[model samples]
Target: MILRTEIATILKAPPIGETVTVMGWVRAWRGNRFMVLNDGSSAETLQVVVDGEQFDEETIRGIGFHAAVSVTGELVESQGAGQAVEVIAKELTILGKTDLSTYPLQPKRQTMEFLRENGQFRMRTNTFSSVFRLRHAVAFAINKYFNDRGFYYLHTPIITGNDAEGAGEMFRVTTFEPDSAPRDEAGAVDYGQDFFGKGTHLTVSGQLQAEIGALALGKVYTFGPTFRAENSNTSRHLAEFWMIEPEIAFADIDNDMDLAEDFCKYLITYCLENYLSDLEYLDARIVEAEKNLPKDKRRPMGLLEMLRFVVEDDFARITYTEAIDLIMRSKPYKKGRFEFPVSWGVDLQAEHERWLVEKHFKKPVIVRDYPKDIKAFYMRLNDDDKTVAAMDVLFPYIGEVIGGSQREEREDVLRQRMQEMGVHEEELAWYLQLRTFGGAPHAGFGLGFERMVQFITGMGNIRDVIPFPRAPRLADF
Candidate 1:
């Protein structure tokens, strides 16, 4: 088989007289005769120009957008206005045709809502092609960041026995009807008939599983899907989201913070280097019309440089108590009550995070040493007793992209902490076993992947960046 390379690769090469084959989807028609075709190769649309002699409009009529085609012709170099050179086709074959009327991905612009409805077809469009391609680059960079650091990638169970965070943040599952389930003599429903022995739910965090592995393997990380039952209808919150968690044994609070910052910088840099061209193509063609959207509205910068800046600079850290003091001193809103009230001990709200990152610090800020009452019980208690060694990395556009902590490693301390925190002792004996054993001190962090995509792409709504975003009241794809 005489194989042919992509049309874009041969654009500036020696194709003047040699006949070569190029396969791609018809992206558009320019002038009265020439047509552009793509192979879904990269973020770019490879151009194939046609001269009316052997490749007349009547020769290939009514071949609508996204129609698959093959052009066998000489690759020539020229100073044509529309496309660089041209494909003076020896033969043009329309392999697959689409109806122009309802193809959904025409040359004209479509709304994000409209494109979302055609998510399956939207990838064929230039916009989603770039978004998803960049998404792939970032994900690869995320894993490579940890793997290069001698960290083992641990596959945590999706069906969890216990929720990592004691916030009742899990989606309960059952084979039987939920409402009419059988009960025990004590009126509490017996869960033997449930899916996973006692009861099971989608995991809210992989921190616990990562903990088990980290204690044994010494250093570990988990990149997997997580679920939260919280009825959040905001752009930043998702019922099902991807989380990246790295756990290390014998690591202190400071060590965990260092890892968190380095990991972020590594991911950003990796994507920027590998996917800068793809992003530019995606931005120019597919999303050019949609730049008016808040997320796409930001001044464009090279993805590679942005990533380098993230890793190259020192990230600022401020304690939750200090952050609250700053907010109080500045007084974000001059008068009225806050929608999500805040104080020294309160959990930081999205608005509060936005204010701190967007207005106050104006950089990637890690708000650390959170109030214990508002954080997970697994966090190490600070010397002051009121706060814990927990941190949340907040950025300008995306509020809280990461949450981390130095875990409670002491057996007696952990047991007492669990009980005092009102977490069920019976449901967590397995987790407690790690503490009972060699259990050296360990710490880890969980980064919301979708939120990171939203941050990187500057896409306002989380839905657009994800392939098929799963959020409350919006599961359409």
Candidate 2:
């Protein structure tokens, strides 16, 4: 049997008269003459010319949309316009014939929601294939970016006893029967009798554990799945998502912000340089998607334009205080356009952040020194005692892409912050000991992998960026 060449490879360098075997699903079988095939290798598909007279009735009958097939043919320059080369099929074998009457997908345009419901076949579509390809590109760029910078990739535990964010929203990890489990004297479920001998839940973030690695290894990162049990079913929220967190020792808030900006630009630039085809497809996808929307509702720039602008421009940096002041002084706030109320101590909502990035700065913005009360317990306390040395990197479409802080390394201060935030010190004794033993000033931030993908791909929903999305009342394959 002859080896099969990938459509992507053949398309990249066409051997004008060489015979090659290609295997892929039929994207389209037009008038029983031309078979468009794609093997998920690249966004482009290949045209295989089939002579109805040369093929028997059975072989011709087997060819249809999405039917798996292998073609042994002579490669030649195309007489067509869209593609440069074509395959003249000398032999055709049906690998798997699809019964189109029952198949969920069609060649025509389908709604995203409908496509999402049929996720098993969604990748076969152009939009999703491009999305997942760029998704892979971004993942590769993430590891490459960190590895090139001398950062080790650390795998944090998925089932963790510690809630790094102290948000009390976590998916419980238990082997016990939920309705009939051991109970303590207080009538609470006896977590001590459970799998790990105590309460444990899916980790919300890997920043805390990555800090340990950073303390020992100088620089480390964790890129893995993190879960949250929050009931939000919005476009931006996901029950399970991947996080890329990098922790660096001896780094303060300034260093953290600089790293965040540089790292983001690098990811975008890498995609632009290497995966322009996929990006171009997604870019055109957005342009076609937003054609009907009102002028103000549409994006200010096209996807490629926006991505290049982000990579070329410098991110604006300001304190949370300055951000708040700017928002308050903006015309929208003056006209009471925002739905969420903005105040000094309260957390900044997405609307507020969007205003700062999209309307005010006209570029990516990093807002630092958020009020201590609105931040996590581990963030370093500023000298003013009112704010923490924290920062959030905001982009045009996605409000916050990265959030990080210079950790509170002072053992006493961490203890006080824990108590103030209602987190039990006994539960994190080892965490405190890290500070007591050899903890240096460390900083790290987490980039929501799906959010960055969504931003880069111009995907409207966070769920669409991930292959299998987990959301409220959603766990479909």
Candidate 3:
């Protein structure tokens, strides 16, 4: 019986003179003897050698690029440079074959745009494989972090009756045919006749449901897919993405910031320690990709250095009002470098956020106490009556990594804010009930999973980090 081994494992410590079977797709076939094999197990590939005397010429030529094959061989010291060991094939079985003419992924370097169009096969590429592997590491680290911290993992519903963000940017879920939907006397589509008997939509955030779990269980978190129907075609926005929302009972906004900081640092430190090889690969890619850029625009630190900086350094903590003040007095605002002019009460654009994290602070920043008018209705109202206890965690390359706040636990204030925000309280009666009875101070935050992956992988576009990106006009796998 041939012992099957993953290419990643075999490449780690090649067993000289040991018989083994390597099953993988042929990455490249050079001459009649050498073949590079990859099994989606790691960023590294294993080199397979076919003895022309033992293997027939027809069988050798049949091993096409990306063809699934199993090679039983003796692991011997490599006669060539680069790799330490090579497999001397004694038997070769072709599992599957691909037509090179139709294949989108070639052995040569392909552009990110081309890879995106062929996202289905992008994982086979070194760059994307590294990104996806790092993404997995980040996700695992998050689950481990919260799991070790005595937090319950809550699974929230994907379909909901009320918009969690209250932004109304939700994809309506209905069985009714839109062209022939039931109409009322007012000539409107009657949602009452729908399958759910009420208007429902894809959830925009899981923070509300997670809050319920936190109240009962003390500390809880939700890691699930969330949808937004915004038609933004930017690099930051996504139509469908994953969110990491952690809610804690008896916790204030300060506690929220503490958790956010620790959580982000944990993820960064975990990735750096566990995924150094893949990260180093991605870091090299970033360096090469940015080589042609202007000196001023190039990233100051490589991917590894950036991760270390976040992990080792303390995040700058400042209030939103103070950030605005700093921006107003800074050279960027004075020189009109900001695309959106900075002012108090104005929402900070990506430029402003980059200025704080990348330029001004030069580290991860926690900006809290945003103007209540610019924040969600559920945020705790501060004593100033104008600002809410909202905090946003900003990273160097990525602007807003996490957005959260202390929930408005006071029933009266919540109702007034809901009314002012024109949220139908009747639809959210259950959410209001949490505040009405035995409520304690609670806080939570939402972290964009893909954005975090993009930052760690050094990928420019959000679509590149996600496995199957769902964005404006592009949902193809």
Go through the candidates in order and give each one's C-alpha lDDT.
0.77, 0.92, 0.90
- What lDDT score goes with residue 161 in model 2? 95
Best by lDDT: 2
Evaluation by lDDT, superior candidate among 2 and 3 = 2
- lDDT for each residue of candidate 3 in 142-187, tens digit (9 for 90 to 100): 9999999999999999999978787889999999986999999999
Please identify model 1 stretches exceeding 4 Å from their true place.
7-18, 82-85, 177-181, 186-188, 281-312, 331-341, 473-477
The global Cα lDDT (0 to 1) of model 2 is 0.92
Per-residue error at 419 for model 3, in Å? 1.7
State each candidate's clash count: 4, 0, 0
TM-score list, all predictions: 0.90, 0.97, 0.96
Candidate 2 similarity to native, TM-score:
0.97
Q: Which is the better candidate, 2 or 3, if ranked by TM-score? A: 2
Q: Is candidate 1 or candidate 2 better by TM-score?
A: 2
lDDT of 1 by residue, 125-190 (tens): 776777787788778887778888888999998987787887786788777686888788998878
Better of 1 and 3 by TM-score: 3
The parts of candidate 2 lying over 4 Å away from their true place are none
